[model samples]
Target: MGGEAVQTDITTEHIERLITAAGSHGVTGAIKELGVARTGSIVIDELVFRCEPPRNRHAVPVRIDLVHGTEKAVHVLRLADGEPVTSSEEAPEDACVRLEFDLAELVTLVYGVPRERSAGVHRSELLLAAWPRLTAAYGISDHELMGSVQRAVDSVLGGLSHRRPSLNELAVRYGSDKWSVIHWFTPHYDRHLRDLRNEPVRVLEIGIGGYAEADSGGESLQMWKRYFPRGLVLGVDIVEKHGLDAARLRTVRGDQSDRAFLASIAEQHGPFDVIIDDGSHVNEHVLATFDALFPHLRSGGFYVVEDLWTAYCPGFGGDDENLDNPGTSLGLLKGIIDRIHHEERDGADPDHVARNTVGLHVYHNIAFIQKGVNAEGRIPAWIPRSSDEINPR
Candidate 1:
């Protein structure tokens, strides 16, 4: 099945073009025609695609069919006047078309990443280009056809400009297109991760979901797994998650905020190349995990903490308006900033954190701590000699 191809009337490229130009319905219809359904609704609007032989074409009744999970299903019902039947059943005498699809293909149809500048082509232009074939398939008077297709195109494009490239195009492709899920952080992530896409690295993510349920978490882990192909993905949560472990993926249940438990994790499964804390966003918990895990990160590795806005909330640690509370994660990170320049100020012996932290990047509600010893030693203390003074000497 890996190298096998599935047959369809439209080329996959054309289907993709339809999807990018026409919208979700284009994807649903194209994928359905390819037998690629899995849990979603397929809407057939008769008025839009009028059938031939005027008797069968009077504002065809709109039908909305629900497709369940992946199973090579196709309903070969007459688009004119027949009910859907299973793949095993013999199609009725007047069956017009067969439609079906599976989960994986549906995901691809909805979330497929296109090449640069490929998705912004004008929908009207696409419709205009395909007009002759579409008109032959659906009997519509040429005089009235443009208006009908223009309305349909407008419905599909959703007011999104499709004529130019956008800065957030990659984010649109990979992050928000698949589900209702929204992770606004993907664009920022793309900046740092573009080069590491093919590397075989270990990524440690803390906080698996499914609150109070043993096997509920791992969505982020799943995303990471797909994004990193060859990389190993490990997840840790406070609850026991079963049935999620598989090749290149491992899960452990432990309190990431606990120093000893965090240390044990490092010894057992870490010294990680990248560590992400999406765990308990409680200020103390964040500080605790960072303190315990930052030292264990491999040199030149990255340590990231998300959801720092919780540090300003009462339940997590500080007063809503306070940004300087020493007890909050943000406050603790401010302390780390001071540590970065400890050599120039009169202070207690520079903390190991100050010595090893080579870069501290603070962004809105997130922080990235890069670990490495500063190989570029301090600039030689400046002392300029005046020419006259040197000559007199």
Candidate 2:
């Protein structure tokens, strides 16, 4: 050939891998046939999948390539839920969030790296698929949505943050404003931080107790440290044992429900850009703390409370099973979320009237709550005034 088309070297191992997968006998002892195929090298990456139902959410393992973030080639395979839309065909310009996997992300997932923790964006579609199968075998929701429910919320929020303008366009055409409701704080930890100011931003999270103490508070504080290294994070726990490096995060001692205690911290701290309660899950404490310190929140700040199931749990305040003994306070979150959802504030839900349910979700499995400031808000009454003290009955 006058000009040979560039040919790269190939390996027999890569060839055999493909054939083996094609002939791969699945658990049923049948030959495996995947719907799609490609070849690429593995590199450091992560994979996540979220299914909201009427659907369950699951996460795949954390796959880490020992090699540096470099490139390598390997075979690629895919199985789509509905149809295959390749680059040539292009996913039809549509109203749905689409999935696209980099070659490295795909390879790492299929190779099945060992994972110590499998949550957050570290979750993968493969894990989600396998989890249901596993639960089916055990016949239990044992591997319920906890490990990855927040990941699902993250997916929705991530998509919404990117497609706000598209969503507005859809609303104008569809004569429906409901899409905005759907997008609110869907996946948990669904954080949308405002631009960090030149002033050192500080965040104080209360009730870093047990799980929230470990996961939400710890992880969120870490995120602040990472995303806004110039920022400071403080965590307070009831047990006085908050996790994380305390140099950056100061752990305080006091009942999150106690106005005196919370006010003290607020007074000492002066102001905070963000304050989250992962604590008492006690409604009184949540409402009280919000009232006392919310004003201290920086303009456009975020104040979030996690695990709002208490409002509906009879033991907490509403009438639900105490199956898990999530504690009396967990139920309070239900009321808080309900208030946010119904906007049972000063007036009716004018902004939220037709919207009986808020974009806020009641994940029966994990009760989480979130709130953000509206710079232009008239601030509704039902949002809970700090001093509307409801003594625990």
Candidate 3:
């Protein structure tokens, strides 16, 4: 599994292969592919995993190394008693415990569907000889040190579980507005997205909140990352949001209304499994973005539009008086209904939107458009076109 150079950019395809190998080929096969620099790079990124809080007050440092061939990336997690776990890429001089894992195994543990776990799969080393040095350096008793170590191990191991929190819980934890804040959209999202939870999906969300603030938004992106363990979550905002980029999460600065920019991103990062329009709630922006990105959505994937209440707000180019105005978001959806049934009508050529939209689920202020082949041949063209023709005979 060793390689000559380190892989810098880990693509969605690489992750998919690693997941497939982990499930079908077992540890040896998965590890062999993971040994490549690119795969190893993703496994080593500290941001790819999340650690739980420690129970004790003693600061216990633990080291985890994802090893592939001759290459190894060292990661250290510091669990301070009663504090959140902190991670770093630097290897510690001496840690209370050091865990060594095959690069592929670690990836499987963190991102594999249902998460891979078995008895005696990876290696764990307890640095017993360093205990005295650590105790002396931190001025703690053996009892405290042991307690801290237990808590540290528990915290780290807890994070590697395949079980995920509910979408509402994640939304609240990640500070996303999709929940109780203004909209009760998480439940709807969970219903539509539960099937894709374990998939190695590419999710693109337009409108990274916290306008213009580099580090402010991306709560939903983080939520998506946690919910879809193997997913690559990406966000787009009009402002520069490079601050939010991390392992499996990327941010691009571009206007959602700009078709060219949307097309460019879709070309580079698409055939996306899920594309959400949470950006500017303007009716025009929503319609334009849908036009630009819908084609890039993979078949059977979902395209979500949030905050449809904007369709009635005059400030956002909506007409409360005339809801059927085709320019509004709701108006667009109304038209899609016809497009989806174009085959049933005379002289109706199924356009791109109609041909690809197999299902549409509209909720309170959100809608989920399901992409699939809409060619369920209309009534075999021989079924009675009118009740009068059949009854007259």
Candidate 4:
């Protein structure tokens, strides 16, 4: 199938099943079901990984193919100084080194857990023959050609390994502001989400970052993709993010404050395991999004709110003087605390947030609200309601 055809047929469920098959059936069996075309589309076309810079200053075009029986899907990638500048199905006319693998082996390398070491890389014999021709035709020295090949091999191996960088490391690598001086949110995320690393969970983050620039943001989205190896991560932005979609990462354009829009996105893509509000940070916008999206969060999932400092900033619809202002995000959180203990108070009537929320963890400028059944029965009415009655004062 052509790349377009593969793209049209492939869905999130298709990719998730491919990952599951790789884990359960092993390479040989998975190849029988996955086929070469769909595997190539996922690895080369969808998860277009950024490679480490080549040791040499020259650019290299490496062709990768997924082979299943006699059928193969070929993709040529041009890498310059570590960045993947171009990718196409058309093979280059000029001689170049080629990397080939069984279709299922490629799938295992991309989706298997770190402990899985069954996937093997196979280098084509033509690589040896191409070196001499490359030296003569391109005027590249034998040493330079070898360096380029080594770099290409290293880059491919790095991506294929299931072992991933930590959230902080990925944050720096992807240029996200999450771990920087302004906000140290990665460590907290790691603490909360480390257990869910291998599960096929859906994650939604409200903000897409780079305000208006179409191509500038999505650093955190990349970090989440790496952090949750089996996750399907979605980012919602007010502006269109033209080139940010990837194998498991998707971007949707919408306003966070619009309850209907939030509900629609959640309905379409969610029952999410995690929902993070790193959006506009305007207190009202944050509050509105929480109310609209929290119900869509799956039971035992986490709903996170970042930039709580905005709750005190007047410019962002916050009131510093009245910290208890019910209009702000912090105020809403304070109210939830009461809801958590709603059973303790006489004549207390719990609302939706109170009925569903089981745990509330608040840090300096962020909070993680755990969703679950909050229905521990209230104190028995037979118990004395007043301290005076109990003490007999």
Candidate that scores best on lDDT: 3
Q: Provide C-alpha RMSD values for all models, in order.
A: 13.3, 21.0, 4.4, 3.9
Whichever of 2 and 4 has more lDDT, that candidate is 4
TM-score of 4: 0.86
Q: TM-score of the candidate numbered 3?
A: 0.86
lDDT of 2 by residue, 283-393 (tens): 566666766776667654566655556555555443365533323334444444544534334564433212322223344334333334322444565655564455433
Stretches > 4 Å off in candidate 1: 1-183, 383-393
By lDDT, highest first, what's the ranking? 3, 4, 1, 2
Tens-place lDDT per residue, model 3, 1-393, is: 000112356665666666666556465565565555556555544322555546757777788777777777776767775454555665587688887877766766765657445676568888787799989987988887888898778777767755577999888867899999689999999999999998878999998898868788888988898788777888999999887776678899998988999989988888899999998899999999999999999998999999999999999999899989999999999999999999888899777999999999999999999999999987776777789879986
Instruction: Report the number of backbone clashes for model 1.
Output: 9
Backbone clashes per model, in order? 9, 29, 2, 0
Q: Give the per-residue Cα lDDT of candidate 1 at 207.
A: 83
Better of 2 and 3 by lDDT: 3
